[model samples]
Target: MLQSLVPLLVDGLANAALIFFVAVGLTLVFSVLRILNVAHGSFYSIGAYAAASIGLWIVSSGFSPYLTFPALLLSAALVAALFGPLVERTLVRWTYGKSEAVQILVTFGLFLILEDLQRMVFGVQSLYEDTPMALLGITEIGGIVYLNYQLLLIGLAAVVIIGLRLLIRHTRHGKFLAAVVADREVSQTLGIDTNRVFIMAFALGVFLAALGGALATPTSGVAPGLGAETVVLAFAVAAIGGLGQIEGAAIAAVIVGLARVLAIYYAPALDAVAPYLVMLVVLLIRPYGLFGSVTTRRI
Candidate 1:
């Protein structure tokens, strides 16, 4: 039992890391923009597609395989740079202060459009680019071989969590973000340039989502409906963690990931529903989530 549990734990942590990236981004966007972005998952699929295409090109061109590692980051950066400001400035800006229904509808429409666009561009077939995974090789834990890339993902997730905390607690931009989150009107009154802050926050969220997708591309195949699937799972994580809580999202991701791994190991039929089951139980116990609380919002 100990040997079997060790591998499960390792797999769970790796899965949690990927989920944390997208869930944290979703939570961050909600905390600052006050809008739940229904289209956020499109950025993830776009990043995966971009990274796979770029990585394949690099390999075909006979460039060093090590180049694929940087390509993942570059692909995510490119997606965020292209879509982040454009979508936030034009569409998302319009939804501010609107009803939640209106915001959801508008962003959902964008999600549909982006999904169709991806189909047209990348087609229905899945794209697989696993050079990075192959290059990293494998590691032995409890007599079970696991991808070294998976271990790297676990470490990367830790770095991101710490980095985000430092950015929020210590950096100037983080303070501006905190000010806005505390009171948007008050921040504006203080000449905080709330609009600029919104744009930056939204873009940062996009970068994180894109980075998650780009990193996943080396392990998973990129397909047409991946965005929709990812969005649902991400929403579950965000809800379980509380809509605006970064630390909550991280913890919730671990719970969901462990639930998933356990289900896969013991009862394969329950694998798909395990995360939602955990979410249901958590919500039943704490509707606001483990770290979430009700707060009055300024109109």
Candidate 2:
């Protein structure tokens, strides 16, 4: 039983790491901006494409294989720098205070546009650039061989969670964000630059999404429809965790990851729907999500 459970635990953690990145980003954006960005997944795909392309170029140019690690981070940063501000300033900024339907429709249009752009630029073929994975080698645990890169991902996810918690709880910027989250009008009245905060928060969210995609490229490769699939799963995670809850997102990711791994092991036919099934159960039990609470608006 110990031996069997080891592989399951490893696989689940690895999967959870990727899901946590995107889900956390999604929830963060919603928490601060109060906008559910339908196009957030496009940033993920763009980051994957950039990382794979950069890694491939590095390998073909005879650069040190170790550079691929930095390349993944660079890809994410580049995506955030390039698209995050632009989207937040133009398309996303317009959706503020709008109805949910309008916000969804506008972002969905952006998603379609970005998807087509990716297809045109990168072509429809899937691209694989696993140089980092190759460099990291492999390890054995409980008689099961696992990619060392996978373990690295698990560690990185833990770092991100801790780092985010510290940032939110200890940093001055975190204080500003917390103030804004608690009361946007009060924050604005207190001389906080709400617009700047919104832009920064949105950009950070994009960075997290892109980072997830960049990291995944070393193992999964990038394809045309990857963003769509990722977005759906991310939404399920966000819903299960209760939107806008950071710790909830992390816990939900683990739950979804375990569900997926278990499905793959025991019921292959349920693999794709496992996360959604989990989401269904969670929603039924807690309509506002595990960490979410009901809000009342003044008339």
Candidate 3:
């Protein structure tokens, strides 16, 4: 049991890393915009499609398989760079200072539009490119074989956590973001361009979500409904971690990840509900979430 558990934990973290990106993006957008953007998941699928396409292209063109890694990041950057500001400027901007219902509705519409656009561009067929994963090969840990790519994801997640902390705690932009979070009106009065900040943060959120999808593409198929599934899990992670809590997202991702892997390992029937069940329990125990505080949004 002890040996079995180590592989389970490692697998859980690997799954959690991808989920963390989408959840953290959602949480970050909510923390700053004070609105839940329902369409954030669209970016995830878009990223996956982009990555898979690029990866396949690289392979078909007889390019170095090593390019797959950069292709993943580039795919995400392309999505964010192209659609992020457009979504914010046209749709999200309208939701500013609006009721939660209105915000959700607007983003949901955008989500539908983007979803259809993706189908039109990439078709309904599922797509995947695993050269990146194959190239990295596998490693045996504690007698259990694990993908080296999986371990890389864990390391990447750690770096993201540290990078985000430094961005929030030590940068000038971080101070502005904090100011806006603490008191929007005061920050506006203090000469901070809230609109610019909003755009940047939303773009960052898009990038993160896209990156998650991109990274997962080598191992997972990109399907039409992938975004919807991803968004739902991201929501669970965000909720369990406490809305707007970055660290909370990390912890919640691990908790959710562990629950998922454990369920898959033991009671396969419970795999689907595991994350939400955990979320329900966490929220029931701590309304503000594990890392969330009632006073401030921290994601």
TM-score for each prediction? 0.98, 0.99, 0.97
Candidate 2 wrongly placed segments (more than 4 Å): none
| Predicted candidate 1 versus true structure: per-residue lDDT over 257-293, tens digit per residue | 9999999989999999999999999999989988899
Query: lDDT scores for all predictions?
Result: 0.93, 0.94, 0.92
lDDT of 3 at 291: 85
- The numbered model that scores best in lDDT is 2
Instruction: Report the Cα lDDT for candidate 3.
Output: 0.92
Q: Model 1, residue 58: displacement in angstroms?
A: 0.4
Over 1-299, each residue of candidate 2 has an lDDT whose tens digit, in order, gives 98899888989999999999999999999999999898989999999999999999999999898999999999999999999889999889999888889999999999999999999999999999988999999998666899999899999999999998998899998888888888899999999999999998999999999999999998899999999999999999999899999999999999999999999999999999999989999899999888888997544
lDDT of 3 by residue, 205-256 (tens): 9999999999999888699998888898999899999999999999999999
Q: Is candidate 1 or candidate 2 better by lDDT?
A: 2
Would you list the clashing residue pairs of candidate 2?
none
Q: After superposition, how far is residue 9 of candidate 3 from its true place, in Å?
A: 0.8
lDDT of 3 at 102: 93
